[model samples]
Target: MAGSAFFMACAILVLFGFCVEAELVQHTFKVSNMMVRRYCKNKTITVVNGEYPGPTITAHEGDSLAIQVINESPYNISIHWHGIFQRMTPWADGPNYITQCPITPGNSYTYKFNVVGQEGTLWWHAHVSVLRATVYGALIILPRAGVVGYPFPNPHKEETILLGEWWKADVITLQNRALASGSAFNISDAYTINGHLGDLYRCSNKHTHKLEVEQGKSYLLRIINAALNTQFFFKIAGHRLTVVAADASYTSPFSTDTIAIAPGPTIDALLHADSHPSNYYISALTYASSPAIPFDKAASPYASAPPSASPFDNTTTVAVLSYKSSPPSSSPPIMPPLPAFNDTPTAHHFYSNLTALHPNSVPLQIDQRMFVAFGLGLTPCSVNQPLCRGNAISASMNNISFSFPTTVSMLEAHFRKIRGVYTKDFPNRPLVAFDFSNPSVNNQGSFQLTDKGTKVKKLKYNETVEVVLQNTAVLAAENHPLHLHGYNFYVVAQGFGNYNKKEARKNYNLVNPQERNTIAVPVGGWAVIRFRADNPGLWIMHCHLDGHLSLGLAMVFEVGNGPTPSTTVPPPPQDYPTC
Candidate 1:
């Protein structure tokens, strides 16, 4: 007994020493912009840490993290830690206007915060509008100290596949043209895998991305779809992909030959590259839905076509999943088997159950319910208008285009606590809304273009709220991936066609609904979400589809009260830019 006790004491001492050593492992990384020649071409854009899609920063939960963002670009920039539970540290939440301001050109800001809370696959991106195109990266969080690894089986090899859209035109010029045209902007020439546009099989003098893998080896693929305004159906030739995780949450491993993902959605899949043939092409094609427009015939010029063009007609080649060079083969490359919706039990289970993998099991009734409609419309230019140079094609959430008021702070404070504050004042539901059948108007009012006001709902520190988003597929718009900052919500129900209130009420996944910070609002359909307003701060909720948000599909929510006497966030860092 005496000898055993001595051994135990030594083991405890060693464990304590290990804990002390772990503390020293915390890392501080600076995510900033540096000019890089993209596509091996002279075209330059500000990128994070000098790399497109930035660098992958990995750390375990509970580890200390210090990230300094220096804006070397000419534009103002800000980085938001997506899906991170910052607890009381709202300062590190990274809202451009709500939190500390953006980093100005030639300035730097260091964001210091501990990686508290759960461990999962998360990402970081620019908070400012449209800048995410160049400024984004992956942030993978491991388990906390003393905790076991993930519940599922771990793979031998892992790679991060960041999917993005690439445009040949200058980004600023493209944006300006789109704003002027008030129509679908630059359709990306190619989709990129990590940053390389595998110019199809026609690999010219340009460096094409080819993933070299050993034959018959299982590899984990962390896929992030960062497209601006498209959803993609991804599949690799001659291999089956087993999806095990999505949006930073673990799901039961389910096999699928092809999986569809939208912008802001991250999916983890295990690929068994063990095949007779060594090399294969991993293809990802856009799943084109109807363009965003009104349902009326007059809204679109191509509405009369017998068969309209599917959004997938144009595809961006992301990357090629290839094995090391093998013996020459006479047979053609084998394409991956297409997934049958009926055969896959997981698909049936997912739809029948209508629940998310990360269920929010909180038992709280919703105290308030809000209905929001997202669509695109046109506003006629007023005569002799200085701001309205011409007719403005715009997007709106609840029938309001975003405007920045001169008395921004006071208006922000008022909108933070009032529901329906702007509804009656800013009425003009867009043309798309009228094109949709049986358009419902809860409030009727109109606000001027000069009014820069926000719609806000006041909630206590911990209030349960439900938001129902109805997408009027008028004008044939694509789906929108809605994202909320600060809180994760339960996707209670989702489906095609219109949202039947009676059916939705019966099919609510209150028990095992997946909790997520972002969700895809299907085209011509509806999505219902429930969330607890626990985090006290001003949080922005917007479409993860960067294009839509830039056009004005976003709003802010102020939760709880401010600091006792004054609740406003501290002034931005000295180097922050007004632009």
Candidate 2:
């Protein structure tokens, strides 16, 4: 019931990460219409600064950034500095209708925030509706100048590999058309590596991408899974990588042949160029853990190519990881063996092996704890729905499907004490309890579909909170990479199957748990995370799967104001968009 709408963001931020504040970094982003060819077709898309993948924002830790966004595209949009802790500047924590309103066509707004207590690979992407499908860029944060260096040895060089998806159909058209029928989703025609769809599909050879590296030198590859829906198995044909960090937070180095990451996740790995200098293939394969048949059925057009065995389509997106001595060759580069599309063991191993190199103490006394359950399900189709055959696909957290605000942003409503913009009545525990891992249990009347609302969890500032995220098997249970905006939380424990709070708490690593903004909740499993809600703002926690998101698998956390002004979030920007 704490409501007071606001606009006009101020530049005051209490520095947290780096003690010494550096000069402000400024950039101008002009969102405009651009036409480009992909999937053997010329398509017009929304691009930032006229770049397909958009321009990268690079800065060291403790640096403030003021990005002026001029939306020239036809669609309304807002950019989010994903994985960056906005501190007191929640107005810059963009999520359409959550923090600020969208920057409408022909409108402009400036996002001002300082990167605090974070260093490593993060990203920026559109926060409005479905615009993020084509608008995202890397936001790299390096170690503060002269204070320290990476936990691993310095790489000879670093490379950014932005893994994304491509669609022949205009995203706006495809999404709107699908939504109007109540069945829009996150599947794409093809995937891309740094904006190039390689030789996997027909007429794509001309747009292939290749990364050149020197032999016997170590390289840092910042791997970002920016795909709207697809989680991926990323590998190099003949090399192994030592993972050093994830989601911009440092982790103890763990070596692996391939990395499995979901959307909104980033892995910073060190690759030792130890393989033969032949043109090695860098490949990405779809990781679909859902048990349900996919909605997409576009088959491989080439009959000569053998059929694939993996449930997630075996169509691989490729690029050459060429050594300086090796050039392109007709001889087929060896393909790295990828685990099956639903390989749970491999995915679990990669996630569980990670630990915080610099362990922070977890709170011994928890202020609030909740068993939050989430998954895909069905809902009664509206009269207008045609894509769904009377039953629309939906997602929910605790049997409640989240619906965004229409009249004002959550911040606006909360600030102005508006009556109905949102409700802090978000359930702390599952409303209808059942054996969460049993796929058959959801057949019951209440479990088959969920009710909908605009709900949020209210938290007292600086309160310690623990969440046991239990994934349900209501539908095709998939590995969901859950992302929380505003603050990075410590991942203390994760496991498969229904979470037994008493038993699970026994194995909790109160020490040395990795801190991250995103955690991949095991399919039909659970993960436990703890964080101190010191930052005052209305934050979002949701499944990063775009399809799941569209179906309403998300909620908000409204952290109350702190004792002092510096710890409190101020008003929104003056030019904030209106509905």
Report lDDT per candidate.
0.62, 0.83
Kindly list the per-residue Cα lDDT of model 2 for residues 203-231, writing each as its tens digit: 99888888888889999999998888888
RMSD of 2: 8.0
List where candidate 1 sits over 4 angstroms from the true fold.
1-41, 180-183, 201-206, 291-313, 323-359, 382-390, 404-452, 561-579
- Candidate 1: TM-score? 0.80
TM-score of 2: 0.92
Poorest lDDT segment (10 consecutive residues) of candidate 2: 300-309
Model 1's alpha-carbon lDDT is 0.62
Residue-level lDDT of model 1, residues 1-579, one tens digit each, is: 999998788668645444423342333334444555544446666677677878787887777676777776777677888877665556677766655556777777776556656567778888765677767788887766564566666677888887777766667667766565544456676677777766552342153566777876788888887777666777888777887767777766777777777788778788887776555667676666554232333333221211112233365464556667576665544455444322223322332343345555653587867777775544444343344444454566666655432222322334344343333232223323343322221111121121224555566666778887877543334467888887777788876656678988887777777667787776667788888877776677887766666567777676764445244434333433333
